[model samples]
Target: MAERPKNDHPIRSPDIALPFCFFCMMNEPDPVLRTLKITEYFKEMPTRDDRESVLALSGLWSIAMTRPNNPEFPEIGIFECMAKLICRGISDREWLLRDQNVYIPYYAAHIIGSYVMNRAEFAEIAVESGVIPPLMELLKGKISWVEQRVAVRALGHLASHEKTFESVAEIGGGVVELAMEISSIFVENVYRQFFCLKQRLKYQRNLLTRGLGGVEIENRKAEEWAIQTQCWSLHLLNCFARKERHLNLLCKRDFLKNLCQIWGGLMIPEAPGGIGLLKTLCKTEPGRKMVADLEQVLKSLCVLARSSDERQVMAIECLLSLIKDPETRHRVLEISVLSLVDLVELENGSELKKPKLGNTLTQALLQDYHKIKYGNQKLHSERAKRALEEIWELKVEKKRREKLMSEKEMKKRKLLVGILKKQGNHKFRNGEIEKAAMKYTEALNICIPKMRKQRLVLYSNRAQCFLLLRNPESAISDTTRALCLSKQGSPHSRSLWRRSQAYDMMGLAKESLMDCLLFACCRIKLKHNIPCYAARMISKQANATSVFGCVKVRTFEETKSLLENRQWGNMTIGGC
Candidate 1:
């Protein structure tokens, strides 16, 4: 440079003390050496100074974000230094360090989490560095949700490793209880204290917005972080629950009730949230019995059972697991049947689709009902037969009426369908999706069976509403109905496309792949992304069918071969 920078001048100001030599700084550009030099400076400081610690931490935080796996930082006492800083931040009463201390614990815990994320060896080193106590302080709400988030995340990573798990677990029942408590309360706390505040700290704003974007982005990131905080705490609890250590604490009736309420929204796809942990608890007999005993919990699971969420299978599995246990089956059968009956007629397929688990559970329930209410005696069997015949006739009668309208009546009904369909379109455009679905239902209800074209449009339109409403099962049913109504030579492409999306939402990769491929082939000008979508579904299906405990993956050659063999001679449809 033509002129030396202010800070690089030979005469340093009283407030601006440089730790490393100028010649050394000019010669040493290596990140590892620079990190070690900073560590040495931190360790050698005669007295604690907020500014120096903050600068050192800022540098380390950047390094941790970029190259977390580097062992040199932790090897040269950085982990130990961070741990001590966290404790000092908690204990420091000086007004001078108070502001800086608020950020120290969050960064420290985050640094510890980052280093130990991928390697258990780093985690073991972190444990030896005495990071547990400081992290525990953050976990217990020594600061705020900002610190608590990183604290729980760091603890979860530590708990995941075999060597460090005991250290975290040894923190005892308090950790589990704290996690459970925090899981239920973190969402409200973050929302009220952070999002609701008129003026927030610069660090809080930076953390929320990641130093970019505006209010909407800040709100969205806040939601994602809030969910993450709750999910991480639940994940921490899941670790203990999986090992079957704190069953009594985890399975407490109030906590289980609170657990039932955690939805783990679509923001974090991989974290199934509280229901995931509840599903894990159900793997044991004690868990099944305790969960089943709560009719309220069973009812909540039933609601989730019919939802279009990714975790819908976990809810169904929990119910089926409960029903399989002889002690709890009767307690659950009545509530389970009410939700599962509508699903039985639908082909739920597999894990990717809604599970056909309902069929087996439903059949078992009916037999149990017949046995319990009507007995196994021959006389009771005859009564059961009569009851079954009456029920069958009721279903037959409803379908029989739809097909038996006169031409004059059909003409009047077709006009009514046209009007209702218009209203549905109007409602949907206005963003009133539920109202739109109802209008479509009204159109379908009165439209005669011969009006296949009108019914097809009505069904397809309603299915879109269901998809928007996140009711994939209903969407699948309506789409299937529309497909069935279309002429054999020309399947309705819109219905096929909607059903494919519904199937994808339910995690039925193979069915989704098949439907997506079929949709791509319809005689319509496809969207530019159609090919990519089909390819994605193929990749997902291939990954879905991977063999357990094997690193090797198989291609979707089988799905491709199956699609290749299918006949597609006459399907002509308009573009979606």
Candidate 2:
């Protein structure tokens, strides 16, 4: 196998400051010896002497994160030490280590994940150090979702390497099965237990607050982490699915049905969620057959394909993949035709800009559909022509009518549009929001597209009404249109604010946060709490993107009792 590519820039762990300062106090100046001393101190330290072990683990975690490519740390048995601490934390319930022991498994697993992330050789050494079994124990929920987060991360790194993948696969189909379950149903419980609950653990408070904020910040951080846990599990599942291992386990009908619903939210745009795994499955025969058999899955993809969500491209790709295979093409063709047709003209559509892939894929799909449905006939099928006409007729007729209008009649239409706007504003003040929205729609219909400034006002006004009606999706679309018609960089601030609010109502924190920031930037001076609110969301996002940010806060007592009472019995790895 070729060598794993390196990360040119490694992520510096945010928790490194205090640990690095502590390491600076050491008399030994050699970095390798310093690392070895730390590892040996952690490995040989007796249980219950908690402070030094915590310090040691922190130092090692920093080293692993900041300098993972250095082989000296792994050669000194750091991975083995991490495995030992993890196992002891799981099986041994020492009273002295109780308060601090809850943190050990998380740090140990994080250290292993960080070190093995970019280097296959390091991953191989990690597998050799017996990290997988202990990591599997954590993956099986020996403690809590926090430990499971890092454990899955570590296993994902191990599974990515050609040499180390077999070691992880050797753990059995249970790993894939558990990953599928986490990807599907574990986020709600994780969110409720750590984030929504009023009682906060000390570690949880430390991670969320970090001496800077309050309950709101903590809640946002918890929500981001909850979503991230699912994202990381999907990453692990993708590793196996990418190579077609455990297809029998990964391609479950219920899992695929649920996977279509997991979009990973707009918060972490990098994570494709369930559609990502489905795309991988569609690459193989059994996987494609399974996905093609689920009409509900196809319907979900059709809905997502028509959405403005970032994952729309992934949805389209899955549909295109389904259509590529002759065997599966017929099964998906009828369901996919209308959705694909909506995209074919987007490249040349009235919108200022759109995804180029949509036009290319849809045109290809339409041609293929025509050939399949009409068999080499040059004549368009009635259904195909009707679909195309439905898409283009109104826009074409509008242009043609405007071109034929006399100057006298055009001036009358503009006058009527202005009168309609005033009436809409009057209705809005009189508490007739629906009537106000209807007035704006009528004004917009009469308002020509060339009258962009007029159309902008109409769209923005309608967006406010949609917001009041609790239809955020429509509000987002209207504000988007208004923003497009406004100035390029500094669009209308009201439209930005409305769109931000709409995104927030849709549970899209990052999108809302971005629009909020942009809205502030558009104005010279801010008069509202948007800046403060944006700052809070920024803090939450910072925590969300941190290397080990998703680790749940398990109290020492809870961790100890849970680990002690946990029993393997005859269970296989990841069977829990």
Top TM-score prediction, candidate number: 2
Backbone clash total, candidate 2: 1
Residue 467 shift from truth in candidate 1, angstroms: 16
Give lDDT: candidate 2, residue 539.
62
- Candidate 1, residues 1-576: lDDT per residue as tens digits? 132222121222234554333225424789777766656755753136534444456556778879988887777776787788788767764522333444566777889999988789999989998999999988887756788899998898888777888999998999998888888877766655555544444555655655567766776677678778888888778788778888988889988887776754433332477788888899877788789888889877875665434466678778878877777775666556555543433334345444445355445545544455455523224433444333233234444875676677768888899999999999999999999999999987776545778988998999999999999878876776676566543667778778778878987654565566666667345544456766676577556632121112233454334324433111111100
Instruction: Assess each prediction's global lDDT (C-alpha) against the native.
Output: 0.68, 0.70
Identify the runs in model 1 with alpha carbons over 4 angstroms from their true place.
Answer: 1-52, 95-101, 211-217, 265-271, 345-576
Clashes of 1: 3
**Per-residue C-alpha lDDT of model 2 across residues 1-576, encoded as one tens digit per residue:** 222122111122343333433355344688767776766655574354434456556666777889989887787787888898888888875531344445577788999999999899999888888999999989888766778888888888898788998899998899998888777767655654455444555454544444357777777676666667787788888888877899998888998898875655423332467777887888899998999999899988875664444566678778888888878876676566655654543332223565555455644465453454455633234564455444343345566888898899889999999999999999999999999999999998887646778988998999999999999978876786676566544477888778877877876654565676677666655555556765665565445434223445566556444434545212222111
Judged by whole-model lDDT over C-alpha atoms, candidate 2 comes out at: 0.70
TM-score of each: 0.62, 0.65
Instruction: Give the root-mean-square deviation of each candidate in angstroms.
Output: 17.3, 9.7
Flag clash pairs in model 2. Answer: 146-552
Clashing residue pairs in candidate 1 (N, C-alpha, C atoms within 3 angstroms): 352-507, 352-508, 353-508
